[model samples]
Target chain A: MKKVYINSIGSISAQKTFENASFLETIADYNDTVLPAIDPVYKDYIPPAAARRMAKGIKMGVVASKIALAEANLENVDAVITGTGMGCVVDSEKFVSAIIDNNEEYLTPTSFIQSTHNTVGGQIALGLGCNGYNFTYVHASISFESALLDAKMQLETEEAENILVGGVDELGAHTVKIHRLINHIKPEAVTSKTVLNSKTSGAVFSEGANFFVLSNLRAAQTYAELLDVKMFNTLEIRTLSKAVLTFLQVNGLFISDVDLIILGNNGDVAYDTYYHELTDKVFAETPQATYKQLSGEFHTASSFGLWMASKIMKSQSVPEAAQLNTIQTSEVNTILLYNQYRGENHSLTLLRHVEV
Target chain B: MSELREELKEKIIEQLNLEDVAVADIADDDSLFGDGLGLDSIDALELIVMLDKDYGIKLSDPKEGRKIFESIGVMADYIAEHRTK
Candidate 1:
């Protein structure tokens, strides 16, 4: 019944995105198996006592949400929805190791309390003193898309005006070690300049927090209009284009209508072809961009993709850092973001420039 | 007794991640929580584990910890009297 606008945005990724002025002007390039986000000063946003107990993921979520709220010029919101794949892995690892190290004796509850997937949403609600609907989605790579869909439904139905939605994941030492053992992370470090060409079996893993303020009412802060969002748990490479076409058609669009297509190509030789196929044939003429080289690969890394798309729509400029193809459109309007993790959890998110 | 108080202060600083507050900043009689060092319920639980694991002094009730952890002076005295390890 109502149009949904991305009123405010916040991002804390491998690059310095927490500050709104810069949009991938300088990318934080890392050549590591597991990358961590360049952090903002936690003390300025959170009190010392509260921050001390917060794991990396929670702090990122809280700070990113605050930035979104501040940018929207709002004190509180109607709902807070968050998504995470690993869900506070730093604290989960601590709690599990503490249990084993102490022989299940004299264990404290702090890490255990913070280890849940919904803790970020709960903590944000507590911080804002907003006890409205709080939800968290943990659907692997499509986690962020799921949260966005939930918020979009409410906003479109006019059930809620302003909703805070975010996606966050923190890298854990033990988790990285296990993924490395399983070859989920690339064998060699891949730099941003050479990530897509690495021909690697695994990806360079990373973590980030990206948030958005969604409302039915558009204001000067509106970044873009959230046209549509869809997620698929399993997708074959051959059927990928068909799915994209159907999604676009349902949204009253066609392949030629898309101005830019943001892909999630993380240099994994086995699964990247799913995205490559789309670029090679179906959406070849569309200007393309990729972000995993800058954000690294995580379950919720697609939120970083959404953040980039929103920035492009609002600023009306596509940074050279995110360019995937040499083809640039004269007038960029509609952006199609497609992401999948390890050949599963495929997500399609469409964002368009808010028509003035 | 003064040595024990200083040791308690250092332990509190390290355990609670009080990076801005140093040992010398906390006086012996200063309260450990609520308008003093500003510790909360979570910090109290951390101190309880410290008592059991570090000093072999276990208090089954967390309410008892309120009295024992009132100040650095009180905490040091309790540990000195009850420590078994």
Candidate 2:
């Protein structure tokens, strides 16, 4: 089997991730229950003509993918795989609202066309004129993990040399209102310093697009070698520990072998117990880090977790802001990323240091 | 005729998110698609909806929009003649 490496990464998140020169150095202070990503100037990466029709999700996806491809120094890739849980939800809301308000008489196809979950992948393919394999996964929180897994399989089997894979989601006002009504979002704003300690029942909703180029051929831009990625639609809280153990054991890793563990603790008092079980028990001694507080909570927030892992490996330094524990490592190498959404769609992604 | 043409330009700019373009930027006879204003098929769909919603002129077949939406002047003329609202 061929080794797959994260050759390049481009992220537009709640923080200033798109610049590549900084990684959560100066954080964006958000005290709102619903946070929005710090958007990049779309015109820099996308032409105005093409960007005019793109909604937030598409714009973010296109720009992030372009950044990834550019960093990898490639104009095109063999495949484009995207995972979006809510799809172009902003467009979806627009289309649905238009249909209702206009009584289905005057309805534009732009929003409807852009509303599809695969629109990002499709648009990327269109922008690059890549007619090769293109697929989009829409599995709730594991959506991004699904895309990464597919890319990994193809790279491992040598089915494709390089692949552009991404997880993108845009905020929808209607969706946020509904999730808020159901208490899926925090009732009040919680600062990053207080998000974990907020003891809230729901997370701070947010959106982002994180894209990476995965190739069997490692490059200087390679962040780390993606060892394995696994997703579970449903895993009992009790068996979660064993699942992580088995995942690491299969990869020839142990609890101590992991230099760092990046977690997806979104500050939901209810579901966070799942992570607390691992961090408070099994991996208690390991250096733990949290990111959902920084990126805010979205379906594919795990991709943000992966992004954090990749950055830490590349720089060999974990941002002081993201660490959940003060126990720092001398040399950062192996990383285990664990993320779950509202006690479901659990994903474990293992990445290791690649000696270039 | 000129008033409607100007109004159409303003509306088109607003509806299509042509933030960089203004009402005066689009001449009366400028092509709205493919090289002039550089609109695409999707923009045509949006304009079709705008016609039905704002002017009550429904063009069920989007392909038929090619003639009416050839330019701001053409669209204004068509809407001026057929507008029910």
Candidate number of the best DockQ: 2
Candidate 1: what lDDT?
Answer: 0.92
Question: For residue A109, what is the lDDT in candidate 2?
Answer: 81
Q: What 10-residue stretch in candidate 2 chain B is worst by lDDT?
A: B40-49
Off by over 4 Å in 2: B60-64
Taken over the whole model, the C-alpha lDDT of each candidate is 0.92, 0.92
lDDT of 2 by residue, B1-85 (tens): 9988988888888889897998879999999999999998778878887898899998878778999999988888899899999
Tens digit of lDDT per residue, candidate 2, span A164-281? 9999998999999999999999998889778988987999999999999999999988999999999898999999999999999999999999999999998889999999999999
The DockQ of each candidate is: 0.65, 0.81
- Listed for every candidate in order, the interface RMSD values in angstroms are 1.3, 1.0
Per-prediction TM-score, chain A only? Answer: 0.99, 0.99
- Residue A121, candidate 1: Cα error in Å is 1.1
